[model samples]
Target: MEVYSYRSDQLAASPKEVFQIVNDDEQLKKIFTILKDIEYSTKGKRSKGAKFRITLGVRNKTYRFRNEITEYVENEKIVMKTKLKQGVITTLFSVEPKGAGSELSVQSSIESSMGVRMFIMTVKPVVKSVMNKEMKKFEAAVISEN
Candidate 1:
């Protein structure tokens, strides 16, 4: 498995507020610019073991995947491990309040099958760039929400 991440140095909202926004699929969908749609397969608020399917539009192509929240910590962190057509991707988000702003970070662990390992190398950069862009969009949306 290969892990990749991005952290932001700006203050948007409080960690608690950010957590609320991220925990709800509807709020999260509004913040994701590239998201086509996201549906929670399970009922109730987002908690550990919640499952969701997400479709993201990127580079003129749409990629769909299903994920489950394996870990959830209020105002602090979330870890979602998704099953893709080619591999298992684990994504983590962490938030910390700083002096005048909060620090937000996202990490992804890509566990590829032997057959898809070679393809991962070629797509890693693209994935990183896309993740960066998406996080930025999410940040801006949350900030504007307050």
Candidate 2:
């Protein structure tokens, strides 16, 4: 398994505000350009055990994945687990109060087969670059909403 993580700079928002924005599917699609679609596969309050089908467009190809909310803590954290053909990708989004604002942290772990692991290692730099760009967009969105 391989892991990647990043913590955003402080933004002019509260932890609850950050959590609300992150959980809003419509806002997320607008903030993250690579995301094509996100539809909830399970119906209920926004909490742990909920599922979603996500579609992402990357380099002209569309990739779809099943994502489940493994853990959720209002105003604090959310953990999503996505299953890939060759592996599982777990992502955690956490927010904490910082002075008058809040900071958001994101972490992603990839557990894959040997072949997929080798492939990931080769493109790790590219993956990191894309992730950084996405994070920047997220930060901008949060700040703009403040």
Candidate 3:
């Protein structure tokens, strides 16, 4: 299993506000250009066990992953797991109240299939960079909304 984590801080926003921004599908479309499409499969709103089909570009290669929300603690954390063609990926979003704002952290891990471990090793750096860039974009979007 290979792990990569990125942390970004945005000021003057409550945990609820941050969670709303991140959980909103329409808002997400505006924040990340790499995401081509997202279809959520839960009733009225977001909740644990809600499934989504996420189409994103990774390393210039478009991939679609089906992610299921494994855990959702309002204003605190969200955990999602996906099984990609190359591996299994888990993403955790954590929000902590800081002063009058909040600090958000994303921790993700990717475990490649035995046969494709070499490919994952070779592309680890690029993957990490992409993840960092995405997180920065998310932070900027959240901060601007405040």
Top TM-score prediction, candidate number: 2
Q: Estimate the TM-score of every prediction.
A: 0.85, 0.90, 0.85
Over 82-146, each residue of candidate 1 has an lDDT whose tens digit, in order, gives 89777788888899998766899888877667767887777879988887778878888778878
lDDT of 1 at 84: 73
**Per-model CA lDDT versus the true structure:** 0.81, 0.83, 0.80
On the 0 to 100 scale, the lDDT of residue 139 in model 1 is 85
10 residues in a row with least lDDT, candidate 2? 1-10
Model 3 steric clash pairs: none
Can you write out model 3's per-residue Cα lDDT over 1-146, one digit (the tens) per residue?
66677765654688998988977888887788778899777763467888888898766789888998889898899888988777778989899998889888888777657666776678778878877787778877887887
TM-score of 1: 0.85
- How would the candidate models be sorted by lDDT, starting from the highest? 2, 1, 3
- In candidate 1, the residue pairs with backbone N, CA or C atoms under 3 Å apart (3 or more residues apart, or in different chains) clash, namely none
Compared with the true structure, model 3 gives a TM-score of: 0.85
What's the distance in Å from true for residue 145, model 2? 0.9
Who wins the lDDT comparison? 2
- Clashing pairs counted in every model: 0, 0, 0
